[model samples]
Target: MRHITSALLLSGSLLSGSALAECQNTGNFQQWLNSFKHQATASGIPANLVNNALHNIQYDPSVIELDRSQNTVSQTFLQYAANKANSYRLTNGQRKMREDRPLFQRIERQFGVPAPVLTAYWALESDFGNVTGNVQTLRALATLAYDCRRGSFFHNELMHALRLIQRGDIKVPEMMGAWAGELGQLQFIPSSYNKHAVDYDGDGRRDLIHSRADALASAASLLRQYGWQSRQPWLVEVKVPVQMNWALARLGKKLPVAQWAKQGVTDVSGRPLRTSGNAALLLPMGRNGPAFLAYPNFDVMLRWNKSTVYSTSAAYLASRYAGAGQVRYGNAPIQVLSVAQVKQLQSKLRARGLRVTKIDGIIGEETRRAVRLVQQQMRLPADGYPDLTFFQKL
Candidate 1:
């Protein structure tokens, strides 16, 4: 996670909307901290534990700044995939899988999640625990909980962070992680840690920060809880026909493998697509970029990280580790829209009675859906992706 900024707070841009009305801290930090201490103690957290963990925890403005500065609007799916699922990660992930073959086998047999998928998450989340983070988890959670924006959400996370300590899952000093208070190699939030962390090493403590076995097993456990299907395909690169109705190429529109094969979709080798069950045509960078058939397991991946780009990258990385070849970037350099351009397009889309929740310069799911609606109305390829041409037409 990135550091937070204080300038954005001065403009009130960081603390707007209903978040301001719900759990917004209007008083001093000390007062808020004291009140939170009482609440924590009341919630069954030991008074000493609460005090020790929260003592001298000044509000971290940088945490809030980093939270507000997060922007994935400028990154295309290919660029993100290239950065995240690069050669280095692939090599290291393969090596890790080979090194820990026995552990992985055990985890897969018990959790029903493949080793490659867990390795991909391990590689992507913290580079296999090389760089978990350095932020003081409690302080960051306290800061975010005190802030007006997302205060209530972080407040609950703070409670869970304290709960982790109370349960002896981790020591207060060891509670260091991302700015969002996500702990461990998997970068699980405190709530997730409480819910899914396991003591795979059988050392009596669920130590995710230093225990690879625990972290990997915990990751698999989390995926299983999110409805991962055993021995099912998560993602498969495919060649989509150029002449088909592009509207069908959407993440929400799932069709059976045989149905997609009938519609002219094939594996990357140009062979007919053959797989059990249904899959969605995932054109993350639009029709002019790489394509994949996302299965139900892919949806389970989304439950881990909602970003389509990140989920797709993780799934593709897993496939690569499992012996799939490089993704084929479609012919032509796909045009991308700038953040400002995306905001303008969202404004135009919202004006036309489309359901765009916010024009915050992010090409999120709603924005993509709105763009697809416009493209369909204009008789263009409705791939649910925004490009310069689509923006110009709008």
Candidate 2:
């Protein structure tokens, strides 16, 4: 939550023999188990698995704090990358790239998920092995499973954690991670590990904590499983022509790359559009700010987390490692406006009876087209640029 993608949230202290003994008091744990057994078993999670997990689980407060705190702290994409690209992160990324070249190469060879991308995750998620926290896995899962906001997801994942413990893959103490119940390096969720973790190190245990091979492989495997197209660019900064079509340059609606090219959109340097895949356009800061052309891989990252900022940040971070310079957008047709002005413009259109969705500050494609229609109706230029005058009319 602290700009960290995965949060492991195992107990800070490894359970001592005494604490283990306390939790293993069969009756107390059974009471906790009963609350979930009925629902989990009815959902087709085997009863044995449910008991196997619940019998060992406990509550972790750190995870709850992390979940709650995450919403309060938001960092812009540049700031996130810059903060993570500190000397520590870069040094670790470099060390991992060299020390684990074979492992990184394997991830690339197997999944076409490049090494830098995996390494970026390595540095970002866990500081390349320097700081995998010591949270108790079962405890973290149990806490999240009990939390109402994400009980169903955590409950299902908790069953998998129990399955791992029951199978003797990872014990309670070593199952450490960030604050959010993500496990090991490359910060996998329990279900993510259960499905794709590999014994790349072949050290008898697929230990994501210590093994670079296992972590990178698991990370790539997760991406591939989520439909990452091999060798496709995930994101590209583009130049919007002076009279860019406000409606088409929107993420809310699908537009063929060719159609966007037809509308005079080009790569940041004004090169002809080279991509063939269907893509969507997004302006997180409205029309006056940076614009992006997001491809299939962008959607794949969205599967990890849906916020436009997060996905774009990942794409940009990975691009930095890939030797691309920080992208600069063409001069914006309209000056950047604040959320208030943007919303006011939208409200005006709605007042004029446009089928606008809401007074949400974000002017998505529908809102853009709707604004353009209103502009044309007023005999204005109809370019769809938001300004104080646009709001004054309504």
Candidate 3:
């Protein structure tokens, strides 16, 4: 899954009526399945394989319910980070690295991605593959493909899943994984499995579900494909000057490390910031919380999972696995906004002629940008974070 966090936050809105009529169905599931089978076979998938893979597939309403119930807005940065990068994960990740030293060294040399980064992802994505979800992959994909909200995306994923089955990578009955059609230890969706999966163990098939070598190596390969630089830093916990302009703390505003140092940014110990490349000052919980200098490789983490909370936690966890200490919280406690409050804040921003696409109560990138704009106008620290005080001002 390219953006696993975003994939879980799939919008619940239905497709346009014409589009819904073409794919969405409850009672007409059989007819839609037949049509999809015909299309699959016409696309050169062996007809018998298609039939066997999709046999006895029924519409799964539970998948739709789970999809609609997902929400990540209520979580504060600290709350989300603590949950994803807790001590349990850190310990297990270190152990995994030690257990597979030779394999990790080979992958690092070939793909330029550190073992800790892949280990952090594995720890978070599936708890070191202990809980890869019990949902039937074909059933979930078929049900989602027939749903109107994200039918086209899931439909394409379902087709790729069929191709995986045809390629002898996995048998139809053994294809069980996440509710979002993700498979294996790293929770790769069908398309990613087809694109970047590698048989590092030389086992003939790229089996991410059962083989640790394949899963870990494939994850490194995927990161390398997403522009992961060898021997480059992804994130560094830092201290930001209280008097500096908070508007500069944004993911898009990358400045040279020297420039940031000239502007009063420093390492956690108040030492000069020392790095060769540009880095953005990422204030995940605004100016009053833990801060970091996110390097170019950090953007690659975002490509893996769009949510800042997830990416930051994964990066931080990777850092801890590499022997970094605990993160230091800022002077004041961060005020987290509720979903209702965020909706109200979005409405207020809209009334002030700010560009907020939807009042979905989610603190996505767009909402954060609009919040920053409003903060800038009000002569407040424009850190792009929403809180009760910001809401009251709006």
Candidate 4:
């Protein structure tokens, strides 16, 4: 499986010679960029390709800013799904599916991945190829690699990008994409593109940038590689019995659909839901909010994006492509916490003797479980979701 990371570039405040010297006791970003040349050459990447891509590349301070601020965008599952799968996106996705019916069908037949799933990813990654980022891929990688926050990760990606250039998979000028060096219509990072991209059109090149067939096929290929089952539902919203085990609300704990149905779980309409495959109960908001039974394809989507919000959005969007309606967020109103506010909550949890070690402003499972503990102590719902009320008490 391929990995992804992000980075940044030069700043006026960081340009002071002494400050540059103090960064890892090596040198400034420019000096590090220059030094990377030798490493690239030694790694067997052609010196000419390296020079063409990195010779005059500048540090992008904006990349770092975007990377840090990305996590601050927190929203409830309903809100995120609504924004991602709006009527505009759904309409455009359906039109694209009709326009490219033959290609989508071919991809599905070959890869055993549904067309809607791939279409959802295509829409989400680059707005159906209408809004790819303008950052120079090499420079963004170099800036992030030099930043040292997640240096080794981005450094590896940067090297793979250079290899892609040397191998002539993509041209130097065409390597412009997201700030994190993601390329093409589906925005696969350099490493993921290298591993999963395919020449589906038989044009002798796996051109994810300009070739719709290649991009769509490549995305389907990725899901297939991750063990996607054909035509299986990724998720289905259900009405869960109030007296069921609350701990099963955590995502990814697989249980049979019949087993959950035995416990009074039913489809959105409260009718008995029958499914042959095992699924996981997922309560993104809380037990009091909407509930879903996520299948293996949902996990495959998670392999594409670690965020549950993103995976759920993709799943929901794909369902919409199948003519499914909007999600019903019954019960209490959804409340979300900003990354800064999450950090504050994490700090409070840390003080209360919870293992909240990296306060990276992301409310991951650890933070969520910690919230559950705090809620239990305070005699609250203990649903494991944070809100203004919970944070206010802290």
Taking all chains together, each candidate's TM-score versus the true structure is 0.92, 0.72, 0.93, 0.87
Please name the candidate that would achieve the greatest lDDT relative to the true structure: 3
**How does model 4 score by TM-score?**
0.87
lDDT of 1 by residue, 203-238 (tens): 998999999999999999988988999999999999
Off by over 4 Å in 3: 1-27
Question: Among all windows of ten consecutive residues in candidate 4, which has the lowest summed lDDT?
Answer: 9-18
Q: Where is model 1 poorest over a 10-residue stretch in terms of lDDT?
A: 3-12
What is the Å distance of residue 314 in model 1 from its true position?
Answer: 0.9
Tens-digit lDDT track for model 3 on 255-353?
888888887888889988777689899988888889999999999998887667778888999999988888989757788888788889988888888
| Best-to-worst lDDT order | 3, 1, 4, 2
- How many residue pairs clash (N, CA or C atoms closer than 3 angstroms) in each of the candidate models, in the order given? 5, 11, 1, 3
Per-residue lDDT for 1-394 in model 4, tens only? 1112211110001121112222332559878887889899998988887887887788888988765544422666777788889989999999999999999999999999887888998888888887667889998889889885667778888998988877678898898888877888988787778888899999888888999999999989888988899878897878877666666666747888898888788988888996768998888877767788999888888777766777788888998898777787855566767878987898999999997765756666677888888887887766677788889987
How do these models rank on TM-score, best leading? 3, 1, 4, 2
| Model 3 poorest ten-residue lDDT run | 9-18
Q: Give Cα-based local distance difference scores for all models.
A: 0.83, 0.66, 0.83, 0.78
TM-score of 2: 0.72
3 versus 4: better TM-score goes to: 3
Local lDDT at 241 for model 2: 68
The residue-level lDDT of candidate 4 at 183 comes to 84
